[model samples]
Target: MTTPTAKRWEIVDLIANRTVTAGEYKPSIKDYLSELTVKPLTGIPVALAVLYAFWSIFSSFAGALVTDGFMVKLFDNYWLPWIQNVWPNPDSVLYFLFVGDPLADNCFEAFGMLTSGLFVSIGVVLPAIFIFYLMMTILEDSGYLPRLAVLMDGLFHKIGLHGYAIVPAILGLGCNVPAVTATRNLETKKQRFIMMVLLAVFIPCGAQLGIMLDVIPETVGWVMLYLIIGFCLFGFILGKLIPGGNPEILIDIPPYRRPALQNICKKLWVKTKGFFINAIPFVLLGILFVNVLYLLGVIQALADLFAPLFVTWFGVPKETVGPLIAAFLRKDLAVAQLSTIAMTPYQMITAVVLISIYFPCVATFVVMLKEGVKELAAAVGVLAVIVFLYGGLIHLIGILLGVA
Candidate 1:
């Protein structure tokens, strides 16, 4: 060890096994890029640009080419027709389940496991899932996400959440189930509850985003913008409303490095495979549940039951009641159901918005309950109020913007 009185410039160079005085090298591209991401003045813009690029690639390009161009044609032109041709009887449960009422002129109207199920699951959602995960994995592997968390630390601090809360928020974009579990990373019960509530209410998972992009391509950005704004605003509101002391962020930021292709592919495959494995069954089950409800005339009963709430208050059709119920099982499927309904853009926007905020899926609900029963109950109550309030108010916003 060096003496306490040693001069600062006389430090030892034992690691290199030499008495080297100093070393110097020019800053590399990675260092320059790091500077751009860490500085407050430039970091936010860079983050926005990066997000915009990912959105364009996921929503516009993959959505248009893979989901719309390929999946839509495959589903509508081939899959639905083939299934319908084989099961043509209007009165049969099989026919109705696979080919819905033939009156509505859209694939979503069919609501079959092979028709809308295949269409929404394969056509619209698959591309979005793949692209969003691909970009997300890239970001994760590159060490940029931590830098982003650092950059947003100030804003998150004001919300009574630390920058690390961004982890669950980012995870939520992939799937809310895991995201809810991720809230355990927070130090306090109140923080976990707040994070869970905000995520469940505002953050649209990748699968939901995928279908939304496919159906309402032009308005997805605006819809996403609304949700993102709600995320921060509600986080701050919850910070104040809930009794808790805001904690300072403690995180480690790693140097930027090129992501390995093999690791990226492995992670991408694992996440996407998990989503498909978990979500597809729920999608199919939702279709079957909808069919059973329809056959029993329960759908009409539900439609009537929620008509005043969904139709009068939210400005969406009463048929949305089925999708709203489906949301309890799977939100992406609920969003998929919107494609079949006849509605103005305003109605569709409100429907998607409500679907996102109405409630967490069964998986997330269980996780939240496991985290804290009382808190989960409070969260459920809050969800009810928000779903109705935001769902109704968005229509007015859409009308004022003249998009309705």
Candidate 2:
């Protein structure tokens, strides 16, 4: 072990590193500094969060106007028709294989404006992500996010978490990656693991919420409310069931103040850009995968298998199976797929609930790997079982209550 003097020196070096990189961050670990809260301001942070959510809703509306009015008109009507004219029967087999021609009765459809993942992302996901990042960065910087551990202590206790467990669940809404990173704030390995598991299973992000609205329009709010309740109730139940060390409530409450505009802008730009860079590729690939699977008649096979389940139990169409499967790859795309099928309000509510509780998502799955292979497997198995069980339970209750 290093001598006390050396540890002090090492910590000083670390603080210097943080101050330089984070600009506003001060990560001193000295006894006096350790006692001080890192968060220096607050009210603005919470206001910013509220603003960000609504702002995203507004911006997405504006984006929809632009994409629908200009892009859709230009690409779908003008460009696609010109392409079809030039191709004139586009009857070639290989062409039909890759790009389905409805005219030729080929199953696959070509990558067109209608199926352009990029267009959809621009119209829907980008605005929501940007707003989400802006809100989250403020919460994180102001230190209220840390204080949330304190605020939610009582609530979490009702859920099964020692106060420390609340941190990951809240952060999970911003992004599961950082939420997993924030799990380090938990006091012990067990607390972090359980919290991580819960977050991956129940917490719904704003982006997910946005897509859910578009996919199943009739009962989005009710679905969201139910999902939140499910998250809280199940989390409480699991926390109590698990035999682990009691979680203590210890957080640094930073003073409240107005958020810095410059800081918010800078962080928002970086985060939104980073999100687009990472997610755009995955979305395009998902689109391509769906197209190929549909081309090969694979989607139909699975749809047939699940038609009864979707129509009878969940109250959605068999066609919803593809989107539900896409959810295992990306929740946004899965939700987007829901838009094409018809369903009642009850089905819409159940669909969103099932989607919210269904999977940890691909990104979440990767984060679970950090817990080690065996631990990740156990975590996934438990999550998978719980999601379906809870979904089925909700459906049964709905039926009994005449929810449909």
Candidate 3:
């Protein structure tokens, strides 16, 4: 027996009749706000306000209330002293590695696996990342992120990314490991590579941001300004250079809703737990590794060897070599190490910016590698070029301003 096949229009009409229903739609406040957030006229100012609030809350709660107000005092006054006094033989290798400088009064200068490591990871970074994740969770759960992405689509396309590229960029601010993975959401290999390279080089993780605020609050703004400029400039250049299809953005904008407390707490817990498991060990190990390098005279030799280039080209002290090494493991640790170095404010700014742009932390590197080895190599090559060119450009600007 032969079955009769419905015509294409008839099939579509049958499906529509069975699945679609007509109803009177009434727009609510949520609809109005969603439209407002995606429109250029209203969205830009709202975005600015949202970002300003995010920064203010981040700096105030994490930097001021928690780290500066609580954790710093506890670690510096109590923990450092107790560990220093109890640990045997201040000159002993173990003591130096574990407890750091016995005479050092603060945790920041202690530079031990236990002292500075714990302080940097817990005291500074923990609070910063906790608050960051909390706010990020709220933004995500409330359905603001996609709308923000829509609003940013136009600018993102200028750099060869769609609006959704903001997902990885924002996530990169927390940790580039996840951000590197988040790039998988992009449509093209070119988009993923550019986003990975840009985030790895320019977006300072929350841990690093916390340390920057604590260590170089005066010049952190300058460092961020340089980073932003580099991100846009290099992103634009790479977009044009890399052969790829720059497809138009297609995204679903969900209606804004009240974020659930349960979901927010769960996400916060997951992210915080990941940070504790992954980041703390790296911070501690980075301190230990750098200390061992110092003991073996590797750092000193590197400083001496690189002094000419650092002084002339980068216009910063070569002592930055130590922090650069630490930066490979954990950038927050690197920034903490940088704080102990003696440099002028401009030099400090330059060194911090260099540390940020020089390379991704080991975790980020691993994730990028997971994406593709050839891509990783290409990204690294691009990174090397950026470091030399952008670092020199910054130095030239500083020289013109008589600051370098």
Candidate 4:
């Protein structure tokens, strides 16, 4: 037995019938990797590099290649044409529902279930979702997420959130529904609400980001930059307004291990299936809503009603009213619809930014309500103010930069 001592070391006497000698243990490769990847100063740059690589691969390579080169072209050249051919009558209600106008160059302009819905849901967004989740799952399993969170703890504390809040924020990039639910891990309602607000206002879900990549590839980085700046700025401001003390982060940093391929695939499948099941139905419903509203001529009416706010203030076209209405159902679908309009990259960016901040999808809204009605109401008020002010602010920025 060793006795307590004031010094760092205490020696214990060992008694055994037979003497035994053991070889010394040597450090493994993971031990060396951690020194660079998880240490304080080096960890930050390495994390940024990993993130940059992730964005480049997911957005520029896989998303562009699989979505634009293969899926969109497949739908435009074969699937959409076949549907249009089968239902040649443009005036038929069935044709309107499934095919929209047969004369449109591609499914994007067609705005129907078989056309726009299929293209946006399966063709444009699905591939990106697949790739994004694949990478996310890999990171999650490899145990690097906590180290990255630690690197971000100082910055997060400045905004009244501890490092652990990064989990929900990262999850928000995949989908806000789960992200909102993940907030339960937070200690206080104020922290949860603040996190929820920041997610709803700034983080672009994978599907929405996919459409943005397809439509505004050249400036997607700039769009993300603007959103991140807004996220940090608003988070700090909201922290000051909301009453909450940020608790210090206490987290376990797991040892890094090689991620198994089977596990990654299974996790990807579960997440992708959830997204497909929830999001695809809403996309089809969005197409139906658009067709019915356009048929009733109510779309134009609503466009007129909101013309001053959307058209004049936001500097986007009146035609965006349909997409804005559709945003409540599925934001990615709304972003897809915006791509069909003949707007400059700046106008498109303005609409994208507004939709990002305006409100969560209907499912997320219900979750917020369940969390607390009063809190939800206050969140709504904050959303509205930010949407209008930021919407106008981005437009002014566009003009100054001459992109609008």
Off by over 4 Å in 3: 1-24
Residues 1-404 of candidate 2: C-alpha lDDT, one tens digit per residue: 78999999999999998787644655444323323322224434543564466545544553454444465566455644555566545665434433335352111124422334554565456655766676667766765565555545666667555655666666666567667877777776666767777777777765665555444545766876787777777676666776677556776566545679899899888777767776666666776677677778899999998788767766666887787777766677777666556776776677767776777667777877876788687777878777667777777877888876
Pairs that collide, model 4: none
Which one is best on lDDT?
A: 3
Q: Per-residue lDDT for 244-276 in model 1, tens only?
A: 776777777888988999998999899788878
lDDT of 3 by residue, 174-230 (tens): 888889899988999889999999999999999999999898889989999999999
- Computed on alpha carbons, the lDDT of every model, listed in order, comes to 0.80, 0.64, 0.93, 0.83
lDDT of 4 by residue, 1-404 (tens): 54466232422223332355677978888888777776768988898899988888888655768987788789888988788777766789888878887788788888888798988888877887888888889889998988888888888888888888888988888888888888888887778888988888898888888888887777677778879988888889888989867888888888998899999988998999998888889888888887888889898999999999887789999899888888888888888777778887778778788778877988688878888899889989998988888888888888898877
Candidate 1 vs candidate 3: which has greater TM-score?
Answer: 3
> Candidate 2: which pairs clash?
42-256, 42-257, 100-108, 159-236, 160-236
- Candidate 4 positional error at 279, Å: 1.3
> Which segments of candidate 1 are over 4 A away from where they belong?
1-26, 88-90, 102-106, 395-404
In model 1, what lDDT does residue 175 have? 86
Q: Candidate 1 — which pairs collide? A: none
The 10-residue segment with the lowest total lDDT in model 2: 104-113
TM-score of 1: 0.89
TM-scores of the candidates in the order shown: 0.89, 0.75, 0.96, 0.90
